[model samples]
Target chain A: MVDALSAVFQRPNFLAFVIIFLWGFYIMVTRYNLVKKLVGMYLVQTSVIFFLVSISAKKGATAPILLSTTDPVHAINYVNPLPHVLTLTAIVVGVATLGVGLALCSAIYRRYGSLDEEEILKRLE
Target chain B: MSRHFPAILFLLPLFAAISMPVVCLRHRHWSRPISLAVLSSMVVLSILNLNSIITHGEVRYAFSGWSAPLGIEWVADGLASMILVTLSFLGLLALVFAGPTSPKDLGGRIVHYYTLILLLISALTGIVFAGDLFNLFVFLEVAAIASYALIGVAGGRALFAAFRYLVLGTLGASLYLLGVSYFYAASGTLNMADMAEKLPHLLNSKAVVGGLLFMFIGLGIKMALVPFHAWLPDAYTYAPESISPILASLVTKVALVGWVRIIFWVLGAKVIVNDIPVLLLVGILGTLAAVIGAVLALNQRDIKAMFAYGGISHIGIILIGVSQGNQTGFVGGVFYLLNDAVMQAALFFLAGMAICQYGARTVEDVGRIGKQAPWFTGVLIIVAMGMIGLPPTGGFFGKWYIILGALEANNYIAVAAVLLSTLLTLAYFVRLFEAIFRQTPLPSDRLPSDIPFAYKLSLGATSAAVIMLGVFSDPIVQLLLNHALPPGL
Candidate 1:
């Protein structure tokens, strides 16, 4: 139990993943403001990206870039490049999602003049 | 050229959608024709691909000649090929009906309208055929973004509805990606077939189960399965008339197909049925969705909202077949999905037409205009009977197969739910029919006169196809059975 506790404490990324994900979930479920909900979604997305990127980390690894001097590359000395590549694509999609989401929220605000969920519901009714 | 059918099927629409604005600048009248041409070519390509696949086995096209497992691949397996053909074909019919119906409502933004639609169709095609998890996510986002823009394009309460849908859909996609991250972390691969091969060795891992759960919930939201279906009704109700039929017919089905692909193909059915309790949960959810969807639909004032709830109920029936996880159940599930697309498209198309013609929005508001358009009303009754699973309609064969599958699995709960929901479906649709045919005829000036030739052609084709599918379901059932399970299941 002590060893497991130390292992968990040593990995801050894992803790960050849990905290940020739950925080975003709380915000999304509790906040009724439209823009805030979008922000909460982004927070959740960021947490996932961070978790994915962190998975590639190693204790003593450098970047996966090649050099003339490092022709015989040691696998243990290089971090995985695939997750970073995936995260890049994910980040691009995340930006697109935020842009469209914010546009929709703005459109809603223009018509209803409020971003609160209760207010919007009353107006819709 | 024939070998390039899969790539061109999506790339053509994507390129055309990008150039649609420039085309609009050159000639505004060109948008509709451009969309029609794109959809027509898509239909042809999908049909050709399906035929080739049926004859020559699965068609695997690797991107840029990198080959499978190392680079992106597009696999037109039996399931993917059949659904792609059906989706594009239904999309073409909806496009035909859409053009004459909602030009005034869309203002001058019809170019953007067609652009979003083409993008959506392209994304859906990509999703159906995508062989990698990351590729699926990208295509799913493309579809979601296009739908978000399309839903709110008219700028009214639709904006609010679209916003709500975007929030839910984004979170769902995010959760799914997180699940994909776990899968990737566990197996070190993103190719679905490769993952499936590796997953069984790691079946007992926490990451695999967690990943599957996240994906299931994410896709459940996208498929609008019962509890997560809050955004469907308003979004369908408020969308422009031209857009509703296509969205109603194709979107949720594609999402469900994606979910099934992941569960059966990526995770493998052995894990789902033997190693986990997921099938039981799915069965329970299906039963609940069946009863709840029908009951809620009965209380809906708006015709579109009622159908939206009814769509939920049908989804439940499809789920019953899926949860059975056997050959018979798989056949029923797959067949029901195809039948629902036709039945729902015809119903929505007819509703759009009736609304446009009579200026009616609610169930009660629809007067006895059926007398004015007898042929259209006849098609409506035929499609409605199909939804209620009446004999000699496509819907009956689908439900019958599912019931048989449920019995085989000894899932009496799902069987009871399916039977009860059929009765509920009958109750609501009968109410709609009575409203349509029994109401007093309005003044002569209120009657609709100019039923477009395109509307008549598309609606007639779908209605006739529904009947024909019911009568000649044996061949289709054979086709579904032959390819019901992925290899090694």
Candidate 2:
């Protein structure tokens, strides 16, 4: 049982990535409302955050960090922490995207008095 | 001291962009000057770092002093530096042009406009210098989000265009993130160099190939290549005259750098380009886009929209050379990317100024305002010719090299499309010019009598630059060839 669980956990990132990509696709294509689409974008980007973080997670290892002489991964105790650091960059990006996306949504709402794609399209036409 | 500077290459713009708004609050008129000052200073800094980049080969600046596979790093070598300068300079010039275009038209919103543009510039700069898969995505998000806001300001139909862009843009970003996840899981590392090392061993993995497909599709959407380009025309057509030129010139070009970087550096060009399915897919999409973009461009009525389609066509042409996957061919493609943006922006910016001056949105709307706007008309004519790839223009060199590269490859289809697009380009631009420049004076000429010298100076500089870049294509191409795209790959 433990072995099966370890094997599954080893590839846990695949699960996180699939869920995120599919969620993003659903929101992008199916949603007609503008702000909802931005929400979907946030969901999608957060999924990427999950994937990047999962890349650093190990079955039995702590984060790839060295706190003291007692720490194990001093040689090989912890999991890879590189991706965790990289995800800091990703999180920053995600926040910026969300901020800009919401800002544009507000601007759109102000201009058209609606965020419906059909309503916007009617005006454009 | 110098070794550390390259690492902070991306961090500089990142800081400048984050601070532009803060600065604007203290002094509202300060955004453009500060953004330009920061960007120009960066150009000088990059130039100073060239030798370190070229001699030592790829330099990696790891954050927190940790090595790749353990920490985030910024990689700025020759290619990244060159791309940085190109993006920053164009960004600065666009900011300069935007500065003098009276903000009174937009009421009090100029602050919002300049501030967001500075942020966009920073994001574009960071993406060029990112050394890891995750950093690339992060910076791309910053750039894309800012660009979406830049596109639809003061709303109206601009909102429609921005919505279309947001839908497609989000899809592209997610696809890229998905690809990054696959690369991470497969290699267990997100650093570009580490991935390059692990890539050969995982060449046959279905997950890896799927990742490549997702990434290319995503970048393709951002670059507005062929099938993914439906959002671009509307976005460009509806964006304010002030923002149109920047979008026309820089947005797709930066995404192209990200596309090339991921494909070449992370995937390792030799493997990705040679892999049968990937090659075939790229070639097919590229060929179709090449033929279709030009043919479809002929039908556009809006001046900006037509140029947007034309820009898409040039993008397709650049790929024709790129898909060949040879040094000569790829170099032509990259150089063309630079030249294409410059010429396309020169033409588009002038048209934008005309639109602002005459309150005209479409070609037919401008009718005989040529007489009312003679000086603007003359500059527009030079730009229009350059757009058509006429001789003594930068546009011509991009076409010349692509054709030469195709001929070297003995690829007849590419050669045919190159020639065909030029003819189609000329056909459209000539008629548009005649309509705009034909001497039909209006009875009630109420257009602005004089556009500020700053506007004229910016346009004239770019127009002259089109011809100068063409005439000096030899040196520019050589410099780019020497610097951009690693020596062998």
Candidate 3:
């Protein structure tokens, strides 16, 4: 099994993909409540983030620090930091979306006086 | 430097979005022009960008002059450009609809609304343009955040609807991001074209299937594919009349396009067409949404809410075409999307006219006012016929192509669903028309006596577009299909 997993990682970008997408699936399908649902959703989005991050990964790569830190410009063995950077922006945007959604949820709870979907629908009817 | 204007077109909207609140901080009324100017320029820019891509085929620009996989890339392939241009036109039409039918306090929220609109547009444009998967996620977040807020802004039932959307939308967004992460790890390249180049090497792997499944589920929420569409009806029903067109017109289309790009391009034909159960999932789910949406819509009292359900049903029909993964099927889907957005926007706007002119909230109150408002009803009928997919309207063309594609694809059940829904869709809207137009006006609207000419002009413009796009679908389809269809299924 370890060999299978290691082999999956060796033949390209498989292991990283597995870990992220699975984690996302686990979160989204399992969560029930509204905020929890959002949490699950965020977990799934992590698969996308991981997918992006993994693309920039090299077999023996490290943090993508600048070349000048070593007092030599010839060597740059850093992992691709671009996906990480992209995810950062995505993360901020995601947080803003979460804030808006939460604000809306609070308002819904106030107006309809419930956070449960069944209860809300029942009251709405 | 000059080649970068299309990128700037999107950037301008985002920048303006950030500045809009500040600009409106003192003089709130000024936000409309800012909104108008942003939309007008976006439309113009989209047209130019679309023309370039169609005539030229695939215009890609690197951020800060960096190469793909190493640097962020912006792509103006035919597909994205088509979606962008159509989105722009729809945005303008929705704003026009909003300007007339919505509450007067609209201006109070103008700064925030327009800012969100511009930001949403900017993000959608980026999603289309981004050659990289991570960029797509980022753009999706930008658009999604704006939409979640826009849904809740109207208050009342809107908060409930927006809350539902937010929860579901967040789940979907995160899942999509997770899928992107997986794809990135496997491929070592975030660029879509690069992934296509690399994915074949990792074929028959569980990780690929895993990634595809995650993406489908995530995107499925946005596509509102039957079982996953729990958030759609409420979100659409409760959003302001002004925002409905944008929500109904652009939101789902963007998600659908993203789905196609990722599923077909990133995953490839073998995976989407034969492997990984996409066509089957799409077909089954699409058929269900089509049937269910129309059935539910048939029973609706609120015209907007009914149309919202009808819109989802149409999405099902569209997915059937798209899921075939054939060029013809895909092209038909795009055409269907183009027409549906326009026709739907027009009809919704007309509905808005009723709500604005009278104090009426539901369809039960739209009685005999057609005689009082002859022009409104006349435009309404044109838009209605468009929804019915009648002759000389874009809506008809939308149905015709999809039906044709379904038949060609030998998806008889899907084709049947499309045809059946047309009658059902017509039945509800026509009933709406009769309720309002058929009765003799014994009473006038309790609200305003006359709607402003500006609103009418915009409504008329959208109605005209419905007719024009139908008659000239060939050129429009040609523009959309030329670069929209990638090589192979």
Q: Please provide, for model 2 over B1-489, each residue's C-alpha lDDT reduced to its tens digit, 9 standing for 90 to 100.
A: 677666555667667767767777878877667677876776676766665666666667878877777777788866777666566667666766776553733455776787677777777877877888877887787788887887777566776787778767877887787787777778877788788888889988877887887788888999999999999998988887778778888888888878777767776666643357454466567777877888888898887888889889888887877766666777778877877777777766776776766677667666567657766777777776676777787777777777887777788888888788888888777767667666465667667788877677778777787778788888878866776765345
> What is the lDDT of every predicted structure here?
0.86, 0.75, 0.75
Candidate 1 error regions (>4 Å):
A1-5, B272-275, B442-445
Ranking by DockQ: 1, 3, 2
For model 1 chain B, the run of ten residues with the poorest summed lDDT: B268-277
Q: Which candidate is the best by DockQ?
A: 1
iRMSD per model? 0.8, 2.0, 2.4
Where model 2 places Cα greater than 4 Å from the true spot, the runs are A1-20, A53-57, A63-77, A83-92, B1-12, B46-60, B102-105, B272-280, B437-439, B487-489
Per TM-score, the best of the predicted structures is: 1
Q: Which ten contiguous residues of candidate 3 chain B have the minimum total lDDT?
A: B99-108
Model 2's C-alpha root-mean-square deviation from the true structure amounts to 3.6
Which structure is stronger by lDDT: 1 or 2?
Answer: 1
Clashes of 2: 1
Candidate structures ordered by TM-score, highest first = 1, 2, 3
Candidate 3 local lDDT, A1-125, one digit each (tens): 99987877675554665575577567656654566656655665555555565566676667767656657643346776766787777768667876786787777777877777678778888
Measured by lDDT, the strongest candidate is 1
